[model samples]
Target: MKKLLTASAFLTATSLLGMVGNAQAATISALTGYSTMGGASTGMQVRVTFADNTTSTGVWSAVDFYSGAASADGWTLFQSGDTFGNPWTFSNNSSKTISSLFINAIAGSTLFDRTNPNPGTTGSAAGWDFTPVSGSSPTSFTYSNIVNLVGQPAVGDLYAALTINWDSGFSTGSNLSFIADTDSAISVIDPSNPQPVPVPAAFIGIGLAGAFLAKKEISRRQKSHKA
Candidate 1:
């Protein structure tokens, strides 16, 4: 069964989202005006590494910006429909399963809105806010127990259709030059098979020396008994 897990950044109430601009209307928002009226591209990459040291990567590129909109609070609102992309899949070729996942976004990237309604639905649905990491401006998020993608047929680890959109927080005069890019990695770790430790050569030499001494002592005792 598929879990109802979503990854989002800086999520506000949906009611507040009503004030945001709509792509279909192409109108300026109440909070900010349009700055750039050109198309902007957002790129996404998902990489899966199996326990058998095999990897699978998928990439999706789409025009994310219709026109630039400004805001007083430094937030750029993007409706669910504004940054939609097609669904991409990750196939597992390794003999292990996935345990956790991670996501990374560039600086000034605030919101990571993603949604998957039907298991096969490939569009937007939920929202989440990004928290700034210590000693870094860019943001990174980690999630555990994502899915099982190992020890199955080649296509058994296939995922449902999912989509993601990123809304940025920028200062005034910010333009479409600020691209929304994200990279995700999923990996597997097997605790049942721990790496073995190698024995030191000194220990082996010590054991051989002890055996030689015991053999010599036994032969000496036998000679004394044969007197």
Candidate 2:
């Protein structure tokens, strides 16, 4: 009986430890965009990276003027040359469950506008924004009504891309990019800082050792009681 109880206690501790190790948070770095124009053509790239070291790349399409439209669905209004809008969405494809979400955006070589003049200017654009959706349980995230760019470019053509990333509790990485054109190559915009993963092997070793000791102690107690 003593040995049985000791072994049971050890097993319980091991189980609890496993549960604690399973509960961890996920992270997403940010999205970066770049564009260049030569003659009458333009090129652009959008890159996104996740916490687990996964990445996604996208190319931007030809520059188009925006049409005056109100923000609706999951899209937000953004403008650069003329008036252009961008809308974004998110989905989870990892085997491991997700605990949280993070997102960031960087504009290279030019800045796009979301409000005011509506029709954004042609210059370097940079900013970061974050919003939590559905507490902790969310499988898909979507944002629409991004930006609508109106007037056409007076000089060279324009291009842009959007990247999205997420973190899932398991050791997995994923990315998605929305490309407008393919002239530009997607590069690592912002690299993520390395993170440590939980070691199940170590936990298992410690648990087995503890269980053995417990069983030994139980056996000794039983012998003493019988004597």
Candidate 3:
């Protein structure tokens, strides 16, 4: 009977885990100050390093990661040694345009620390490769996959002072603001005036002359009729 009960418990646990996996899965990041550029239309791969030395890669919507004012928009990725593990890597292919990316890893809260001295790293089209921001001791260190423009991967080594936490129930992590097209200026045409067709000087002059001649001809005809 004891063995039977044990078996039943295991089966029940397995079923629950399966259901969790099948679900959309909780977010790793919060939606407080969640702001995105380029409509967060692009999708990027987010990889997590598990404690067992195994890793899992999943495609996450760039908009899910929020970046805005330093005081707001901070989210947590994982706990020090949670199920998702520590240390993560983000990669975007040529298909996606990532103009500017800023990652700040701090200790206080799981949310990103834009105000802290350790503003983790900055990623560009060249690659996700970056060093410490000038004069700051960063807890999280990141390396790039390759220095190529075609495909760049930003690998963040969160194996530092801050205790990494992985809450499977969360949407995403940190105060991450990704500007897909920061280098280029987006010029939105005014909807009110989608197209402003300017009248040419010659066309205006021709229109005025025609109106004047028509009025003069009408007056002459009227005078002749009266005579």
TM-score per candidate, chains pooled: 0.21, 0.23, 0.21
Q: Which runs in model 3 stand beyond 4 Å of their true positions?
A: 1-41, 62-139, 146-227
Tens-place lDDT per residue, model 3, 155-217, is 221111111122231123222211111111112111111111222111111133333443353
lDDT of 3 at 153: 29
RMSD of each: 28.3, 24.8, 30.4
Tens-digit lDDT track of model 2 for 1-227: 11032333333221211101112221112112222221112222333343444544333333443211112222222222221112122333544333323221212222222212212223312111111111222222221112212332211122122222223431233222111111112232222221222233211222455446434533443454466
> Which candidate's TM-score is highest?
2
lDDT scores for all predictions? Answer: 0.22, 0.25, 0.20
Clash pairs, candidate 1, are 8-128, 9-128, 9-129, 9-130, 10-128, 10-129, 10-130
Cα lDDT tens digits for candidate 1, 81-183: 2222211122222334432111211111112232111111111122112221111121112221112224432111112111221133211232221112111
Q: After superposing candidate 1, which stretches have Cα over 4 Å from the reference?
A: 1-41, 63-97, 107-227
**Steric clashes per prediction:** 7, 43, 18
Evaluate model 3: give its lDDT. 0.20
